[model samples]
Target chain A: MAFRTDHHLTGSVNIVTALPAEARPLVGHFELRSSRTDPFSVYTNGDSSVRLIVSGVGKSAAGRAVKHLAGLFDSTGSNAWLNVGIAGHESLPLGTMVAAHKISDEKTGRSWFPPMVLDFPCETATLLTVEEETDDYPDNALVEMEAVGFYATASDFSTHELIHCLKVVSDNRREKKLDGKSVSELITAQLAAVESVVQSILQLSAELGKRRVVPRQLKDFLEQWKFTVTQSHQLEKLLRRWEVIFPKADPFEAASPESRNGRDVVQLLSRQLAEASVEAEQL
Target chain B: MIEAIYIEEAVRQHRRTAEILTRFPKARLIPCERYGEVFNPRSQDFKIQKRRPALILAEKFDNFVLPTPDGFGIGGTENYYFSHMLNCLYDCRYCFLQGMFRSAHYLLFVNYESFMDAIDSTLDKSTTDKTVTFFSGYDCDSLALETVTGFAEAFLPFFRERPRALHELRTKSVNIQALLKTEPLDNCVTAFSFTPAEISEKVEHGVPPVKRRIEAMKQLAERGWPLGLRLDPLIYHGRFESNYRRLVNDLFAAVPAEAFHSVSLGAMRFPKAMFDPMVKLYPDELLLAGPLHPSNGMVTYRREVEEEMTQFCRSLLGDYLPAEKFFHCAPWS
Candidate 1:
C-alpha cells in the first residue's frame, strides 16, 4: 500500500530544540541497547511526539538513525520524515536558529539535503555536512554532520513535500568551546518549540493526501489516441460528404423523390454507421 | 540563375507584401537602420505570429556570409550553412529559432545579388574540389516563403550548374508547389522534418498538420526529387515509443521506402545560457519535462535519457530505412 494513502502529517515547522536540563520532563520512554553505548531516548510533550534514536556520534550513526526511522515508518504506516538535530555555525551568534536551503558535501560536491523553504525572519543558506571532526567551517553559514545523510536516506521513503531537515545552531566551530551541560539543557528547554513544528508538518501532510489521485482515465484516453492521418482524414471527408448530401432536412419543404429522398437514404445509413463506430469504441 | 540587383527601396512591391497590405492596410512600413536590427530583432510578438508568415523587406549589405559551425560537413570535410533570412513562419515550440533570436519578425534581406556574389567568391576560393554544402533552412523554412520570394526558382539552377555543390532545403512546410512547378535539380535535396501526429498536433503550433506534410512528401518523392528525413530534436514523452513507431509506419506507407537519400537523428541539446530565455518563452512546454541536467556547457536531457531516445528512434527508423543510410548527429559519449 502507498504510505500516503494511510497516514498523513502537516506543519509549518519541522523541528524545535530544548535544552538538556529542560529535556528530562519531556522524555516519554527510554531503551538501553548496551552499557557501553549511548541510550536511545524517546520524547513527547502530549501535543507533539518524536524519538531521538542515539546511534553514537558519527556519519554512519546519523545514516543508521535515518534507516531505523524509515523502517519505523514502513512498519507503522507513518507518512512523514523529519530530521531534528543540533548544528555548529560560523560567524552567527550561538542559540540563533537558521534554516538550511541546501546541504552539500564539501569533499565530493554532491548535494544531500533538499532546498529549504523558510518563513520570514528565518535566513536560508548552505549547510555543509562533513565526515571530519572539528574542522574550520569553510565560508558557509552552517556546519552539521548528520542532517545530509538523514535527508538523503529519508527522501526515498517520503515525498519531497513531506520530508524536512531542521538544524538548530548549538556550537561555533571556530571558537571550539562549548559548555556541554548547558548545550544539553538548551535542547530540553526548546522541546515545546520543536513539538509545535511537527504539529504543523502533520497538517501539511493531510492536505497532500487529499490532492493525490491516480489518472487512470487520462491514461486510457492517451493510450487510444491514434496517430494515423489517413483514418482521421477519411472520417473528416465522409462527414463532409454527409453534410453536403443531406443539407439538414428542410422543415418548410416536402421531401422530393429525385433529390432529397435519395440523398436522405444515403445520409441516414452514414449516420448509423458513425453512431455504431462510436458505440463500438466505447465498449 | 539570372543576375538581380539589391536596392534600398522605401517600399516593397512583392505579392506577399501586397497580401499583407490587404490584410493590415494601415500597417506602417517602418524603415530599419540595419538588417541585423530586424533579423536578430530586439522586439516583436513571438507568440502572436502565425505560420506562412509575411516578411518586412529590407536591403542586405556587403557582408552576406560568415563561418559555419565546426565539423558541419554535409557530404565532405568542408560543409557550411548560411541563412539568408531570420526566424521561421512555423511556430513549433521545440524549434531552436525561438531560443536563438529575441524577436519573431520575418526579416527578408532583399539583397539576392550580394548573397549570390559571396557564394560565387566562396566557391571560387575553395577550388571546388571538396563539396561545398549550402544549407538554406537553418533559420527559416526554405520554401514556405518561396511562392512570393521565388527563392528556390532562382537558387535551383545555380546548384544545378555547379554539380560539385549540394544544397539542402530543409522544411516542415507543404510549400513545395513552387519547387514542384520548376524542373527538379539533381544536386539539390528537399529535406523534410517530421514528427508523429500526436506530438505534432500538441507542439507544432501554426504549421500545416502532419497529414498535409505527408501528402507533400509523397508527391515530391514520386516526382523523383531526392528527399532527406530529419528526426532531429527527438522529443521523448509518454507513449513516445509507440507514437514514433506509428509515425514511421505511416510515412513508409505513404511513400516508397527506397526514395529517401539519407536520414539524420539528433536528440535535443541546447546551450546552458539558452535555458532561462527559452523557459521564459515556453514555461509550460513538455519538451523540457524529461530528466534534464546541465552537462559541460549545455542543458540537455541527461546522457542516459538522450541515449534512450536516440536508440529508440534509431531502431524505429531501421524498420523502414537501411541501417547504413541512418546517421546519428548526436555528440558521442
Candidate 2:
C-alpha cells in the first residue's frame, strides 16, 4: 500500500519492519489504515501521522524500504524511525524486549553505539545484524536481520536519536524454529515496551523540533533584508540562539535600526545579541 | 546514573577498569580496540549525545603532562597541567571542552600510574627551589567525579610524597568526602570555581548551586584543606559588579580571607575556532550573543568592558584579601 508523492505524508513517526506480520500488531493497535494506491503495504494514521512500512527481509530490503519511506513521508527529517522485528539472543528469555545499546553489522564487523539517554526499566543489550538467523550467536549480542540496514539508512534520513531499533527476542540456540504466527505473537507481546521507547523518542523529537524551527520574526526579517546565502545561514543559527537566550523577548518588537543592508543588520543584531547574552548571565 | 559504558578492549582486564565495571553492573559495556574507534567518529552529534553521555574507560598514550598556558597559573615558578580524563561531569556553557572535542562522552584514562610516572619524571628534572604547581582540572572537573574515579584519593598520596611539586585540584564539585577523611596537606590546594549564583543557575549545567559550592569550600577550608578561589570566565551578566561584590563579601565572611591560598580572576572568552562552533551548539545561549570581537586571534569582551570588569573586581577583591593573593587571568588565558 506504499505510494509515491507522499505530499500528505506530513508525519512525525515512521515505523518500519522487515515483514508484514511484524508490522501488523503495531498497525492494528495504533489504528493504522492501509491504502490501495501504493505498491508496498503502507499503513498510515487517519491523522496522516505514524506510517508503518512492511519491507521484505534482508539488509538491502530494509535499507531500500527506509529510503523509499523517508523520501515519501519524511521531508522534514523530524520523524522518528522505529525498526521493529524478532531477534535471537543467546540467553535472553523468549519474548524479552531489549533496546539496543550497540548495533553491529556481522558481515562488516562494524559497530554503532546508540547513546541510550532515556532511563527505561527494560533490559539493554547489543545487537548484531546478520544476513540470516544463526544458532552460533558469535558475540554477546541480539542477532537480528534488519538493524544495520535500518540504522545505516534511517540515520542518514534523521538524527541517530530519532532512528532506533526495538527488537523482541524470539529465538536463541536451542529454540531456533518459529512459524509466522509465533513471530506475530512474540512481536505483539512486547507492544508495551515498544510504546515506552516510542514515548521517549517522541519527547526527544519534540525537543529538537523546537530548537530547529525558525521564529516568524526571523522570517519577516529575512523577507525585509537581502541576506546572502552565507548571511542567511548565520541568521538562522543566530535566531535559534536568540530563542534559547531570550525566550520571552520578541525580535520584531525590539527597536529597529532603519535603512541598513544585510551586513549592517547582522552587525547590529550581533551587538545587541552579545550585550543581551552577557546581561542575561549577570546577576 | 550512567546507562552505558564503552570500555576500550585494551583496558578490559586492567584492575581499575574491572573495579569500575563492578560499580556499574547495570551499564552495557561495549568493547572496542581503541577508545578513538568509539570516540573519534564524526557521525556522533554532541547535542544528542549530551542528553546522555557514556563513560569511556580508555588508555591515554602521550601528552600526559603539558605546560599550562602563559597566564593560566595563579603565580608560581613552573606551572604544568595534566588531564587523566578527556571530558567532564558538568556541562558549563562557556567551557572550551565543548568545541575542542566532537564527542560529549566522558573518557577516563584508566592508566593513572602512567600519568604519575610522567609527572614524576618531569618534576624530578626541575630544580627543587622553583615551586612547580601542577594543575589537575584542565580538561575536566578534577573533583566533580572524585568518588566515581577516586582521582583525588589516588593523587593525594602522590602529591604528599612530592612535597616540592604542589598540586591544584580545580573543580566546581562538592564531593569532598574523600578529602575530609584524609589529612589535609599544604602542598595540595582544592580550588573551587564560582560564578554569580544568578549566572550559575543558567549556564553552568549539572553544577552545584553557588551556595552549595561555597559551602563545600568552607568545609574544606575548615578541615585545613588549603582553599583557592577561581572566578575564571566571569560572565558579564547585567549588574555584574553588585552580584560579584555581594558574592565576595558573603564568601570572605564565611571562609576567613586569611585561610585562602590564592584567588584567580578572568573574564569569559573563547578561541574564534571554538566560538563559532559553540554558537552552533548553543544557539539559544545569550552568552555567545556577546557581540564578541576578535582581538589578536581570540574572541572576547571589548577591551573597554574587559578592563572595566577586571579593574572593578581587582579593586573589590583587594578589600577582602592581601593584594598579593589576587591573580588576574587575561581573556582566553
Candidate 3:
C-alpha cells in the first residue's frame, strides 16, 4: 500500500523468471518498460533499481540474469529479489500457489532453507530445481527448473529476508498436463498473491531503509560542508538522536552561518537539540 | 491441526511415533535424519509455520534435565526443569520461546522412556532427605499438548511411583482431560500461568480465557491436585493496579487462596539475547516500549516500575497466603 507508483523512480525490486510469458504479466502489472539487453531479455520502468529479466529456461540463464541485475541495483544486496514462475507438483492441484520453505538442487542433493519469518496466508512446500523433467518425482516438493539457481544467486546478492521464490503449480502426475499458454494462465491467476508478497518485501525494506537513512536536511547540510567520512557518520547518528528527541520536526530551520567548520556545525546542532529535548521533557 | 508430520529416521519405527501417525493419516509424513534438520532451520519462519506448524517426532540425546535459573523454584533449594517439547500451543507475544527458537514447529521427543529413566537417575543422587522438585514445563507449556502427547499421563504415574520425589506440570493450558480422567497425584503440581484477562486477551493469543483456566484449576484442586499459580512476566498497562487487583480477586474467588500449593511472582523481564528477536518478530506491539535499558544482560521495565509492580502484587498476594508460599522472580527481589 505504501509503494504505489514508485517503480522506475525510487525503491528497489528485481524480478527474474524462466520465460518471457512468465515475465509478461509482471512487466505489465508493475508498469515496467523495456530496458538493457546485456545478459538476457531485460525490462524496466526506466528507474535504475526496479527491473525484470527473463532468464530463458535453465539454471545458468537464471544465474546470469541475477548477476546482471545484482550488478545494476543490488550492489549493497539490500534490495528485494523475487523469482516468480510455475512449478509442477505430484499431488497438489494445478493453479495451487505456494511459497518455498526449502530450495534444493536435484543434481547435487544439496538444499537451502528459506526462512519463513512472516506469516502470510499461503501454503508452503519444498521446491526441487531439476535439470530436466522426468517420469519419477524425487520427493514431495514442487518441481521446478530454476529455483536453485535463482535462490543460490539471489541470496548472494541480498539478505535472506529480501530473497524469496513463489511458485504456482502448472502440472502434477495425475492431472492434465499444461502447455506454454496454460502456464501463462496459471501465473496470471496468482498475480494477486505475488503482489501481496511484493508489498511485504517493500514494507520490510522500507522499515530497514528508514533506520539506515539520514534526514534530507542533514544530508543537504553535509553535502554543503566538506566533512570527512567519519564525521559524516557522526552527523548521521546525531541527526537520528535529534529526530528521536524532536520527532515530526526539522532542526535545520534555525541554522546560521556562524559555524566556522563542519565539526562546529555538528556541535551547534547537537547542543541545541539536547537543550530542546530537556526543555520538552520539562514541559 | 498439523498439516504435516516430519519424523526423524531414527524414531520412525518408535511405537509412540506409530500411534501418532495413525491419528494423522491425512497429514503428509516426511522423513528426515534429524529433527533439527526440519525444526531448527533458519528458513522456516516461526510466525509463518505457526499458521500450520508441523509436528516433528525425534529422539532426544543427552541433557534430559537442566538446572533452573536461580530464584526460580518454589523452595530455597537447588531446582531443575526439563522440556519434553520445544514450543507452546499458544502464541503469547511475551513468550521467550519466540526469541530462543527460529522455527515454530512442535518438536515431540518420542522417547519418553529415556526421559523417565533420566529423571529416575537424577533423583537417585539424593544429597539430603529434603524433597527436591523437578519442574516439567520451562521450554513449553507441560499439559498444553496433553491430548496429543499424553505427557502428563506418562510422567504422572512415574512421579506417583516415587512418592518422595516431586514433579510439577507447569502450564497455561486447560487441556486437563487426561489428568481429570485419572486420579490426581500428590507429588505433582498442576501449575497454571496467568496474566490479567485484559492483557492476556490482547497479547496471549490462542490461550483459553482466564475464566476457563481458573475453572480448570478449580476442578483439579477439588480432586486434591496440588495447584500452582504463575504470574510471571506480568504485563503492565495504564490501569495495571486495578486490572491486576481484579484478576487476583477473580482468581481467588473461584479457587480459594488456601487451594494454591504455591504462587510464583515474576515481573516482566527478558534475557538480552531474546529481547531483540522478540522485538523483530512483532515490531509494532507496545510491549517493547519504555525508557528502559539492559542491565547485566537482561532487559526489563524501569527499576521503579518493576519494584512497584512486584512489591504491590507481592503484598496483595501475601494478604491471601503465607510468606513461604510465594517466590519473587525479579533479580533484585
| Better model by lDDT: candidate 2 vs candidate 3 | 2
DockQ, per model, reads 0.01, 0.37, 0.13
> Which candidate has the top score in lDDT?
2
Docking class of 1: incorrect
- What's the candidate order when arranged by decreasing TM-score? 2, 3, 1
Residues B133-202, model 3: lDDT tens digits: 7888888899888878889888888888988677888889999987888787877888888888888887
Q: Indicate which candidate wins on DockQ.
A: 2
Write the residue-wise lDDT of candidate 2 on B1-333 in tens digits: 776889888899999998888888977777876787667765455777787888999998898899877776667778898999978889888888888887888999999999999899888888757778888988899998887798999999899998888899989999998899999998999888888887888888899988888888889889889989888877776678898898888788889887789988888888888887676666566676654666777888887777788888888888887888886433366
Q: In model 3, which regions exceed 4 Å deviation? A: A1-14, A20-31, A45-51, A56-64, A67-71, A74-82, A85-101, A113-126, A130-145, A153-283, B22-30, B43-45, B328-333
Categorize the docking of model 3: incorrect
**Candidate 3 to truth, TM:** 0.77
For TM-score, candidate 2 versus 3, the one ahead is: 2
lDDT of 2 at B325: 88
Clashing pairs in 3: A8-A47, A33-A44, A114-B43, A115-B43, A116-B43, A116-B45
List the candidates ranked by DockQ, beginning with the highest: 2, 3, 1
Range of the 10 consecutive residues with the lowest summed lDDT in candidate 3 chain B: B283-292
Docking class of 2: acceptable
lDDT digits (tens) for residues A1-283 of candidate 2: 3233332223267788888779888988778888532555778877656678888888888888888887766355567788899888787789888888778888998887666777664777888888875687755788888889888888777767677788888888668536788888998888888777777777766665554556557778787778898887767665665665667776655525453766766766666666653565331
What TM-scores does chain A show, candidate by candidate in order?
0.56, 0.84, 0.79
- Candidate 3: tens digits of C-alpha lDDT, residues A1-283: 1123332223477889998778888888888887766557778765545678899887777988898777655354356778999888888898899988778888987776555544455788888888986656556788888988998888776656667899888778887445777778888888888888887776655554443454557767776676777777656655655555556666565444566667876777655543341211111
